[model samples]
Target: MAHLRDQPAGVDGITIDWDAPIRVSDGTVLRADVFRPTEPGDYPVILAMGPYGKGLHLADGYPANWRRMHEAYPEVAHGSTGRYQNWEMADPEKWVPDGYVCVRVDSRGSGRSPGFLDVLTALQARDLYECIEWAGQQEWSNGKVGLLGISYFAANQWQVAALRPPHLAAICVWEGFADHYREGARHGGIACEFVKGAQARQMFTVQYGMGSRGPTDRNTGRPVAGDVDLDDDVLRQNRRDLYAELLARPVNGEFYQERSADLSRIEVPLLSAGNWGGMGLHTRGNVEGFLAAGSELKWLEMHGDTHFNPFYNDRGLGLQKQFFGTFLKGEQNGWLDRPPVELLVRHPGERFEPRFEQEWPIARTEWTEFHLCPETMELRTSPGASGTLSYQPEHEDLRFRLPPAGHDREFTGPAAAKLRISSATADADLFLSLRLYDPQGTEVTFIGSNDPKVPIALGWLRASHRRLDTDRSEPYRPVHSHDSIELLVPGEPVDVDIEIWPTSIVVPAGYVLELGIGGRDYSNQGTEIENAMYPTTGVGPFIHTDPEDRPAEIFGGAVTLHFGPDVTSYLLLPAIPAP
Candidate 1:
């Protein structure tokens, strides 16, 4: 029988269930921490499934992230004891009091759950689908389930929603990358070393094995992975090697498709939210899902600064509640009455101007062209003369600086560049870094997902994988079909279009735009800021350093850039005209 009760430890009238068992169709039991009202009644469910252990508290499992967020915004952890706060998962203390049941599940092999640990695979996605159905059928469930979380948690939504589970009602994809290959393992065609580093830092710590691989929380004597024990050998065999698996897939087709969000199949109402500073992994996927999803009822929201701050803080939490209230609770809260798009137009000094629009790349976007003059190293609109520049692949990058904008201009969308180049070898990797320098010549940077010193934008392409998926591409964003290798002919020029991911910045009058075309990653002279996850490098751990992926013999050779009226190499930028 449904009964209403209150706990002395919780807010008045709220009920909470810890370590609930949710068995999948295959009989594998996944552990979930369920937070709901004590009142015996059907309430909607908010589910977050990830490999991160459900037993791990945000304050304990990720102290650095927690500290950083609290220091920046104390109010996020203010109203509650925050004891139930798990990394990247909803705080039961917050949702339970609001009449919604929040369920956080540790996937197959993480936390106290026992099963094979195959991260982001189709098998894992299927397990999630079963979980949603299970939640819907629960005694306390109202039969409506919604998915919400960050990164791993959000990425799973894209995959599971594609299956179109009956009980699935809505989704909030916050800062999650969709394309496993392009946005994940390989950026353009280069393998990101960040994958392996991330595995070692995050996954290896809580991986389910013989003994708990996590630390015992100071507050709770139990280990972060739980106080469970298992046979070492069996545990080792059950966990899939996430890093090795990424290294094995060089091309995107079936394997990538299986893990990627199939937008065509995701018909549920969803809210796609991204961060302007999350250039590498997150922002692109948010925009892509919003633009291409099969969902007819969708909205887009974007912000800047700490990626972790917004989700838990009041500014973000309020918006999230509104999104879920209308969809999950069927609240008549005029959510559909406002503009469909929300943006935090960023300027220098971490200041963001709040704005609302009817569409992305607002209808009045002025597509501007900045032609490169290889000789003078100037970026201008009109062609000056034919020029050619060449450099050994291992040598310094060729940089061109554009004249400062005459007025305060907002360049706030996806960008692309056409390069006319020939290589001495059969293959060449073109690394493009789009940067902005202040009037005083200091590089303007922003906080990327993990890196604090990320540039304005970045892009990459291999001459071999330069074939564009014309139907899935736009002039400002060239989508490359990284399926087959179209190797370059020695000493012959080929036109390559590279897609620079979405960007949002309001450049002041005297700031200049700089473009760096290089054979390697761009580095800065500024002192690396010490951070929790990684020591500051020009880029974050997202650097491409896998030797097997980029052989010195094949990718290292002489390269050249040709530009003029005949060649017409230019950078396409989405410039929003001043209102």
Candidate 2:
């Protein structure tokens, strides 16, 4: 057993219990660090469990994100020493001072915990359930526990909350994806490489057994990984190959089901904070999860900015504290009186206006359809005369543009595209982008989760995997059944519906809206910004470029857009009428 050390109260009036043991169901001990108020009375607990090392400081593990966040929003580090800040987890300095106990646990096989490492699986969720129960039973705990964090820390909450542990009271999921198949590994049946990159840079570096090879926590002067040093081969044998497993399981089967959250089973009070800029990875899950969750008391708050910034900022922290205070601490904070939906409505020039609403898709939304006119490459209110447009899938794309708007229009909900198309080969990959152009014809882009220049919305689909799940499909959000593949015969046009993830954009008068369809990922032709982990090429690391997934023989071919009286292709947008 490792020696447990309890540090004296610091200048900030917080005490720390280091290397605390939390034994799970299998009797394997997981490690955690507990921070609580020194004045000591039982306090409501806020817990986070994930693969990221609990000992690794945010400044040390993710320097780029830490530097960028502090540089842009200095308030993120305000009111705290910033020494206890971990990636995506609550800063203990901030929470402990507010009379909340903050506990950070290293999941099995990562950080200081020693065990086989397979993340986001049923086992991981079970471990989290045990941890929550453990926190509740602790003498220093007030018998109520709340879950709070961003991204990985947030994503796991949905799964664990379904277990309904006695201690689990509420959750604040900030920018987390609930679906492992659709949102994390694959997007519209296309293999996304983001998982691969994430595993390499985020997980592998601080993996358990790295010992001397891994970084040390500056605060404790101890290795972030365990003390026992292990060879590279031994380390490789301990962790699962996430990328290989994703490639092996291309469909949403038992593998994905075991990892994804059962939204229907989540009954705890939920506050899902989503980012408008997190289109490919984080956006869809938050909106869809909030709607599907069985929780009667749930709220959705949407904002725009870099993914990590909002979670730590005043707006994000305020919402989290209010919700947790009401549910976990039993405070009469009037949280129940707040509206169910809160939106930081986005507009041109990086401006966001805060608006309270009754429900998502805004009850007053006007579902408008803009039909495609292939002859002139225009989007019209009604279908035009029959015409056809073809483009080389490998080299070109078909773009249809809407004329300058007569008045400012707000598109604040879900969007989709219905197209009639054919391929020269048996299979073709379709990449769709919803874009806005200024009066001068310059493309309008916004800061995304990782990329600085992302378009209005993006969607993707492989022709062979275009089968829709009728029971779950909506006109605006088409859910695809990627279990089966149906090849397309040459020159035979077929109708396919593609779901463009939810987006919020207020288009000013004289601005043009365009729909671009291509065989490859959409690029804005803007200079790429290199980040700490990956290069930001308009879409960030959420790219699909695996050669095995898109073999040239099957996916590389000429694609045609058939626009005729019988074959009508159009873009459906959620248009909000003027109040």
Candidate 3:
């Protein structure tokens, strides 16, 4: 194996090898660079293996991500010089001083390694197992290993941890989803628009030298780090394009299970952190992983703000250090004695108020039911005096408005809408938005998983695909089985319950809570805002929309909101207690 040399300067007590080749299964020599204590007899290793090249410097590897982190939370650069910053992973400078070995590996066939690159499939998990075992046996390692990373890295950690590598002690999954088919790549039986652009902008473009790994490195001046012999065809065959591939298998097929982490098999201590703002990819995973994983010593923390900010902020870093110290270092930090769940309830204008709770949904949460009155198209706390309501696609997407009381309203946890509808057509697409309208009747929109324009929190379900997994269903979350599609009769009103993914908001007294039922995605509601673009990945912010699979004739029909007469539609809200 060819060994890469280290830079002379050291940070704290650590020295780093700029580029080192790590051999994986099947004789593939992938690359990783390590930062370890100089006086190391042995130290618990904090390892992250991903598509991001290990040799690539953060200043050069992810200039856009680096710039954004510093701009949002300037304190990241407070104590030390920023040299080892990388995407969605810990800064080596922060960990080395604590006597931890930080190793970053470029996944096989990515970055300097010559082979094929597949993202989070079974092949990648096998390579990760090997990496874990390899780290345990290294001279610099004390044989205990833990995993930490965000997004891509965090997703893979779940997969490999399920394999139960002997040396793998604990894991911190920061906003990583457990079910690939349901949350990531595809949602509501449709492929994600974000992954479609991500492939060209983030994956192959950087691998093939089309994006910000640039034409060459400014510092090394070598042909950037992982420029290999791969072209479009090789990239195509080796890695499955998540967006297109997921579209083919709309059902919960074998493909989804192959990549999904079996939470039942994950037995190590887990710290699952989620962001309130992460709607599509991450929000479900963190909450689901904590609730489902077999780990007896598991904890959950929820925060708000941009996806990447919470991981490095003082609050995030402090929690990370405390958890890792307890599990990895075997310290008596009392972390295990802490509450099982904590939430940073977010207020308007980027304010977060932390609340330590014993369990999710908070025991004191009032599961308030807001019924949808069809005649007035308003949400009310009481069941309507009239019968059920009916609505159809051609009808202006039904909007229900309800005014807040004299006091402000605070809501947290998952939301659900129960609807009774009769569609003239066989199938209907259910698009529900939990919206907030100002006193002037203007819709309030915030940053969403996709759609830079106006977007209130959204939920979707197909009428035919409305079967629930009765065993796992909860009042706040309706767990869809996605097994069979039950076509509705022409004139019969049927009850359909829709799961609105978790959300947090503080509604002022003047604002009104509104729910919109429509057929297709809402895109043109507001002007698009230009968020920061990812320089290294070349992918902009995540974008999502209802794809073309839902034809107008099949989904769009004359629906009747059978209210005032008999049918009743209602929205379920998890109302939080006032502080």
Candidate 4:
């Protein structure tokens, strides 16, 4: 074949001799390193293609990740030789031990593969499609293929599955984001500051720039993948700098849509895994992708804690096996009849309680509203008399607390806040946080997506990027029409409705629901969680404060609150049913 390359030494399949790299219609050579049972027969193949060098062991590819993972998750070290372990994805040790054949290929410009790396482009999807067909034709392959991985590996799975490759059977997308524009890279019309800052260290260097950043084979002193000479200059040319480029253009528009996957075309059987604490990278997309994808046989499972742990834990692994057994093997595993939605509801003190429900925004949810009382800065059942609470440059932001519900309450899913606002400046930024305070007056912060130590749900905004997209606007989520901006008039309060991202929490009895409103972001303080694996500020995870993006002059302003006769402000919460 024109695109095929020479077979490497350790790549021959034990069960059936596999063909070397084969060319596809697109004229691109893709190399595959394979593992199969030492028997002469065909079997379903599990395929994964990404920049993490296939031949590279975790200890060599990313030593820090290896050290941290094993330190936190000792079970990862219990299996086979641990030759196939990688960061933030499936432990190949578990998969290869089973009957399934595992194949890993380096994406173009990464590992041994040669080319300029373009992260998650339409062309990348084309390459994956070819790889699927190539895998199916292998001598040991049963001509049926399934895909599975976390984050980058899983995100592209959605893209290629939409193409509906003939040999493709099923897929498990673990903690993958859905839309590149709205749900990822950019949030609330703003570039994700955390991803922007950590991209180079977290993704590029290991994947493309440096072949082996960890221990080397004592004999050759070379990487397990190839030559380890890949350095900084090569990294600069390897892939499009997603985090940096996103920072230059902080608003959503055509530039962001190029990489976003169109979910309407995806029709294969799919299982989406989500993490509750994965606020920064993986959380939103998992939730949105599950709801948006066109798959009829689809399931969503959400859990708490470090993003990757739950997926590989005993419980996570068991669920994945049952799901694959039913879908890929055509077995009558109970997965076919399992509930559509499953959640590991978290309580205080690191306790996780399991709950299985049919759908999200649970069926028995009570969509309730609490109005802002202007006079006393309190959240009341109804509006107060005519008056206003205004925050000038010298005044503090208005704070309000709602009376505790007699019984415990569960608030989950998306929430909304309606505000009547006037700006002294032409444009204004509004920061709102719906919080829960305990009986001891301790503010509760759940694990956020970006910062692991603090507790906060979804965050959102309107940079006045555009006027409201009237057709898509709803009480719970305000769909902004990023088409035009209407300048504000001083002293005139415009009815600006803000949509907060989804979150899940069970408020204990005697706990008060508090809402913090301000012209700028609130400080992430109080509780500091310990973790040697991830970066942390003084007390906890790093808080985002880019002077260029979050300057007080541009975002901070004196804003008024109206709960009495003159104005009304309130938050709409997705209240879940009590047990």
* Top candidate by lDDT: 2
**Candidate 4 local lDDT, 296-321, one digit each (tens):** 98888887766556766677788877
Question: Could you give the candidate ranking by lDDT, starting with the highest?
Answer: 2, 1, 3, 4
What lDDT tens digits, residue by residue, belong to model 3 across residues 1-579? 223233454546677664566677688886677888888578999999887655456666556556766888998887657666766778888888888989888787566555666678798899889888888999988898989988778888889989999999999999888888777865665455766666665566546332343444343344433655455565567665676677677678788888889888999899999876677676888988888889999999987666677888877889988998998899998897899998877655556678788887777889999887655667788766665445556456878888657778889888898887778777777777777767787766554322223343667777787888899998679988876668878777778888887777788778888888876554443433334442111112333344365566666667765654355567999898886
Model 3: CA > 4 A from native: 1-6, 9-13, 55-65, 208-227, 385-396, 438-456, 487-492, 522-548, 564-568
Q: lDDT per residue, candidate 2, 1-579, as tens digits?
A: 234333455647888877789998899999999998888699999999999899899888878788888888899888987988998999987788888999999999999999988999999999999999999999899999999998899899999998899899999988999988888898888899998988888888889999888988776778898898989999899999888988888777988888888899999999998888897787988998899999999999998889888888887788899999999889999999999999999997789999999999899999999999877889888997787788887788988998987899999998999999998889889999989999999999988877778898999988888999999999999999888889999889999999999999999999998999998888867553434467676898898889888888888879888888888689999999998
Give the number of colliding residue pairs in candidate 1: 0
Q: What is the TM-score of each candidate against the true structure?
A: 0.94, 0.98, 0.89, 0.86
Candidate no. 3 TM-score: 0.89
RMSD of each predicted structure:
3.0, 1.5, 3.6, 4.4
Index of the highest-TM-score prediction: 2
TM-score for candidate 1, please give it.
Answer: 0.94
Clashing pairs in 1: none
What lDDT would candidate 2 get against the real structure? Answer: 0.89
lDDT of 1 by residue, 1-579 (tens): 122122343444555565578888788888777778877889999999887777667876677778878888989877688877888877777777788999888888876567887788888899899999989999999999999999889888989999899999999999988898888878887777776877666765676653455765343345656566666677668787766876787777787787887888899999988987776687889888888889989999988876688899898888888889999999988887868799898887788998999998678889998888776888878775787888876678888898886799788888999989998888988889888889999888876666666788888888898999999888888999899888888889999999998888898999987899988876675344424666556576677767788787888888988776788788888889887
The residue ranges of model 4 lying beyond 4 angstroms of the native Cα positions read: 1-26, 52-73, 207-235, 390-398, 447-450, 483-492, 519-523, 526-544, 550-553, 562-568
